[model samples]
Target: MRIPRIYSAGDLAENTSAELDAAASNHVGKVLRMKPGQSLILFNGSGVDYTATITCVTKKHVIASIESATEIPSESPLATHIGQVMSRGDRMDYMIQKSTELGATEITPLTSERCEVKLKGDREEKRVKQWQQIAISAAEQCGRSKVPLIHPITSVDDWVDNKPEDSLGLVLHHRTTQQLTGIDKPQRVCLLIGPEGGLSEAEIESAINKQFIATTFGPRVFRTETAPVAALSVLQWLWGDFNR
Candidate 1:
């Protein structure tokens, strides 16, 4: 059987025994029905994988003993950050999950002129935590050693303005003739995508003034959730591990 992989929040060390947090414990004891003596791999976004064997499983707790730890070099050399405008329903969840699987290093949910989702206070906090867990699950399934960072919701202009100087920024729109293939490979890329109705003309212009190049896939316009997957995949193929 394929040993299930899980994400642990606390630090793990070789030959150490630790009690898993409630979420992990619940998953191990209730959801997965994992029993004592079964082996599982654990990662904490620390770039290390710990081979662990369950020592105890109970209604409220699960304990594991770390057998060994190994470094995982699964990260892509090309760092890609996506600034995605917020969407409704499960679209944001879908976008975050697929983006993590596609090797996006960081994700910043944006509030745009056309944004449909509004989050604030406790609701926003809860939503971000939910999105973060989705990223963790994606990392586990994809064999990624490190989980992608999910940032708090911010405005499109704020996100674009705060990008690192060396990051090559690209804003997706329908009018642009520029394509991903036309650009030279950079060490990092910060892609800006709009919401359901798409970014406003002024929003696109602000991104351009901030040195973000306008990019278009074709005449077709992709949904907020679907565009990131296609764009990131193409970018990975061109500049990341797909080339290897």
Candidate 2:
């Protein structure tokens, strides 16, 4: 059987014991009903996977003895930072999950003029935490050692203006005919994806002014949740690990 992979927030080292966090503990002890001596893989976003054996299982805790450490070289060369306008319902959740699987290094929940979802204060904090968990779960299932960072919510303008220097920026919109061709390879890419109703003309212009090239996949426009997966796949094939 395939060994289960679990993410641990705490430090992990070979020949040491690690106490699974509450969520992981519940998964191992209560859900999986794993017994002592069963093996599992543990990753802590450190780019290393720890081969561990369950040592203890209790109602409140599950402890594992880390047997060995293996460095996983699964990170893509292209660092993709996705700024996605928040969508209603499970769309945002699906975006985060698929983006994580597609090797997005960072993801920011953006608020655009057409965005329908509104989050504030404690509710916003709760949502961010929930989205982070989704990223973590995606990383675990996709065999990624590093989980993508789910940044706090920010406005479209702020996200556009704050991109890292020298990183290529692309704003996806159906109105543009620009494609990703003949462009010099970039070490990083910051992609801005608009909302269901699309970004306002002013918002698009502002992104262009900030040096984001307006680009599109094709004639067909993808939904807010699907664009990241489609765009990231093409990006990976062109400039990331897929080519290698």
- Number of the top lDDT candidate: 2
Error of 1 at 125 (Å): 0.5
lDDT of 1: 0.92
> TM-score per candidate, in order?
0.97, 0.98
**Model 2, span 1-244: residue lDDT tens:** 9899999899899999999998889888998899999999999999999999999999999999999999999999999999999999999999999999999999999998999999999999999999999999999999999999999999999999899888999999898889999999999999999999999999999999999999999999899899999999999999999889
Indicate which candidate wins on TM-score.
2
Candidate 1: tens digits of C-alpha lDDT, residues 41-122: 9888999999999999999999999999999888989999999998999999999999998999999999988898889999
Can you tell me which runs of candidate 1 are displaced by over 4 Å? none
Look at candidate 2 and tell me the lDDT of residue 46: 97
Error of 1 at 33 (Å): 1.1
Clashing pairs for model 1 are none
Error at 166, model 2, angstroms: 2.2
Q: Which ten residues in a row have the lowest lDDT in candidate 1?
A: 176-185
